[model samples]
Target: MTERMSAEEFRAIRHEPKPSKYRNRKTVVDGIKFDSKREAQFYASLKQLERAGQVYEVELQKPYALTVNGQLVCTYRCDFAFYDAIQKRNRVVDIKGVATKDFNIKRKLMLAVYGIDVEVIR
Candidate 1:
């Protein structure tokens, strides 16, 4: 039988810092840590739009949960959510260098569950 590790111990081993194979680096702006520079740039643009009164409000890392019969199936975190006063609707945005299969599934689920179509920025 294999020995079981506690959750904390498993997380400690799982999340240990390691060099990334890709060159994309994490960046911090306005006390927010972004996964990539492209995401940070997009956030800056959102702020500019907000200041210019184009966007009513901006939120970062909006989370959506997929559930069936009150049981949680999964959770998806989008990069940004904003109310577009011009469009008179709320928009969910995601910054992606590449769209993974899991993201596609979550995007579809967001539509089916929340009826929001996620806008992707490559």
Candidate 2:
């Protein structure tokens, strides 16, 4: 025979604070935790593009290191990346809720270091 747990015990075992509705709501889709619903929507669109053969591959949360003189300075994580066969190039995408000074710096560094332009989506 198995011991039954009480409701208070269950609640205590699974307690987690609810996220504030006023802030950007994080969503989990296909077992991936997106920063916001908008981002998840964009990811879904990417999936469609992949299915349609518009993009060769879709990468989520791609990380790039910004190096100066072969030393790591900072790291930039883009929201999405895809290879466009027609364009014959890789495109990096960033879904930004708010563009901060730090982000701008990293964007510029990415361009200087990697020579890849990030497409910002507001």
Candidate 3:
């Protein structure tokens, strides 16, 4: 039985894309690419805070090496690190849409090694 698919059906099937690597879609703003729309929104908020003088500085994608006993375990890259004038201290922020085992392990290692609490904005 040879049944021909309609043009509309063929077009729809052709246009259907595979699932993306990440759960969220990547977004670009001001020539900078963000992992997700949520991250981009957060970046906008941070810029607003800096302009409002709430935050002194905003640094993104800061990498910290998680090492143990003179051995490098893994590098934990935080989403945002900044000097918070309101809090009167530096803060590390990592907004997790989905917390994976790797992130959990690295987060624990970060605290155990550096004594820095990563602020997770889920």
Candidate 4:
């Protein structure tokens, strides 16, 4: 059986006080902005990358520590992160089949922090 945190325990997490590296990663693919099949393409690419050993899956909502001025200042829980062991670097990823306008702004901000790039999955 999978053990999970209770709602009360999970509620204690102070997410709002800090910022996440992957705040909003989804946008609508139904409209002209994105083709309906684009989502399929994105997932395909992600799978291909995984099979090629270029990237490995990362669990969602897992916290990563970021240090500033020799002090651990903040934490970010990304939707997903791919680890390139060879390069010793990681790529943060967020997947959204559809998203709202507010999500767009948050996503852009997340991209700016830590020089991380953003990928809109569909």
Candidate 5:
């Protein structure tokens, strides 16, 4: 025999946000959920820049596929992408507190294969 919980209790237990493997707590802002507080702050700043017309456009979670020798190796997802109206250049940003070996490998593959330089914000 087991005791049944109410809907709110179930939701509280089931839908609670948990810390990531690196202990980065998730944050929600403007109805958009972000992986970390730093990411969320960056997003807020981007929104401000957009409003100020410094950024022409803003994109979130942009993915780049890395293929080697005609075979797909992996996909690296960027935190944010935007066009700088002042600099007149496109920017791909990754807000990283820690860089893993997998990320380092993916970064090399990205540059070697696509010539895309990822901008890292620590």
Candidate 6:
């Protein structure tokens, strides 16, 4: 087996590749991840919805911002958004273990501006 490299050698390795990759990738302004269990649940639910043909499209962890009067006014990341074929609108679905004051405020604002319904699933 090859001997382990010294800490100094590891530190000296080039890191320029990472920055280039980061720049090319899409950046999210705001977003949150579900704690493991919730994440699994959400993934399963999405699959079910797709099979049922209830969701036309699904946008996962999308970060969006709107500029108002030349200033960036509203910005918030949605957990999961599903498009309804019948309604022809986007709906935001968030999986939360518990509710908070901040969540309420942001949810309301996002719904109004984006014209989407926000649903919290526990």
Cα-based TM-score, every candidate: 0.80, 0.80, 0.84, 0.39, 0.81, 0.58
The residue pairs found clashing in candidate 6 are none
Worst 10 residues of 5 by lDDT: 16-25
lDDT of 4 at 3: 94
TM-score for candidate 4, residues paired by index: 0.39
- Residue by residue across 60-122, what tens digits does model 5's lDDT show? 998988889989999989899899999899998889999989888887887899787888898
Q: For model 3, how does the per-residue alpha-carbon lDDT over 1-122 read when each residue is reduced to its tens digit?
A: 99999999999999998766667878887788998899989999999999999997688899999999999999999999999998899999998888889998999998999998888887
Q: In model 1, which regions exceed 4 Å deviation?
A: 1-22
- What lDDT does the true structure give each of the candidates? 0.90, 0.89, 0.90, 0.57, 0.90, 0.68
Task: Tell me the deviation in Å of residue 63 in model 5.
Answer: 1.1
- Candidate 6: deviation at residue 26, Å? 23
Among these predictions, the greatest TM-score belongs to 3
Shift of residue 26 alpha carbon in model 5, Å? 0.6
Task: Return the TM-score for candidate 2, rounded to 2 decimals.
Answer: 0.80
Candidate 3 has a TM-score of 0.84
Residue-wise lDDT of candidate 2 within 1-122, one digit each (tens)?
99999999999878877775546788998899998988999998888888888897788998898999989999999999999877888999999888889999999998999898899998
lDDT, candidate 1, at 99: 88
Name model 6 segments beyond 4 Å from true. Answer: 1-34, 66-70, 86-88
Residue pairs in candidate 5 whose N, alpha carbon or C atoms collide under 3 angstroms: none
Q: Report residue 79 deviation for candidate 6 (angstroms).
A: 1.3
- Residue 117: error of model 2 in Å? 1.0
Tens-place lDDT digits, model 4, residues 11-106: 778444553344433344323232234443554666677788877864444565555566665565555567866677876666565665755655
Worst 10 residues of 1 by lDDT: 16-25
Off by more than 4 A, model 4:
1-52, 63-77, 85-89
lDDT of 1 by residue, 17-97 (tens): 886555568999899999999999999888989999999768899788888678888999999999998999999999988
